[model samples]
Target: MSSDLFYALTGASLFTLGLYALIKHAHILRKILAINVMGSGVFLLLVALAAGGQQAFDPVPHAMVITGIVVAISATALALALMLRLREASGLAVLPDTSPEELSEQLPEAPSDVASKNNGKNA
Candidate 1:
């Protein structure tokens, strides 16, 4: 196969794999990683297509890739920050809570010593 065709196939494979991972995983970090992978695949496809065109090399795709990189970095940073906040507030990373039992399972209980002390005073 031609070099361009090979690269295009590889890029398409990466994109498909990344999309699968993104959909299959529930964790925020995994989703973020999948997004990055998909972005890389898109960048690779753009570069490969740009290279396949006649003439030396187009600078437009390269510039677009650079801009995409910046946007991805910022988006990743924001996602991480939101994850941190969610963890701090709820003591868990995943969302929806699913069940009351699950939420109860994650919570910290009050100290037994303090409970006993209060009980003794009441008695």
Candidate 2:
């Protein structure tokens, strides 16, 4: 088999695995990793397609892959930042809405005299 064929097969396999990872994993970090894997697979395919064997490798596809990699990293960084913010806001890193209403429940009723005294002080 030609080197191009081998590279193409490898790229396809990587892309397939990445797709599986994205679908099977529920964690945001895992999804991010899967997306990066998919991006690498695409970059590999671009390079393989651009390889002309004898004449010359195409510079256009190479430049495009480089730019795409930069964009992918930027997107991943933004996604991670959002994930961190979400974790901070909710106090959980998992995907489910597990926040309990009991955690935010109101305190038990205070004595009526204490309440009246507090109200009078505020007034």
Candidate 3:
């Protein structure tokens, strides 16, 4: 109907889709993307709400949105770092180790003979 209504609807849909992605995806990277999508939806909703029922633009919500965006970036960075560490340690990206057999299967192979020779030369 109205531009404001459309904005609100879009924002809501984006947020819902993000939530669904977060729930359905098993990859850590995908979860991060979903979080960013949800943050964008919130920013859109805030901007839309600020524009409504006011003649002059509101700086307060705008400032808050900027701050929120920064915080979201920080959070996403931390999440990525943690995910990387988990992947490095467990060889799995998202979910925790459930079966011992699967964990053993995911272990990295031993270095090749050429690599071993190189290491011996360096030593």
* RMSD to the hidden true structure, all candidates: 6.8, 9.5, 5.9
- Arrange candidates by TM-score, highest first: which order? 3, 1, 2
Query: What RMSD value applies to candidate 1?
Result: 6.8
TM-score, each model? 0.76, 0.73, 0.77
Top candidate when judged by lDDT against the true structure: 3
lDDT tens readout by residue for model 3, 29-86? 9989998999999898988878877789999999999999999999999999999987
Estimate the TM-score for candidate 1: 0.76
Model 3 clashing-pair count? 0
Point out the worst 10-residue segment of candidate 1 by lDDT: 107-116
Worst 10 residues of 3 by lDDT: 107-116
Candidate 2 has what TM-score? 0.73
lDDT of 2 by residue, 49-91 (tens): 6783646767898899999999999999998998898665554
Candidate 3: give its CA RMSD in angstroms.
Answer: 5.9
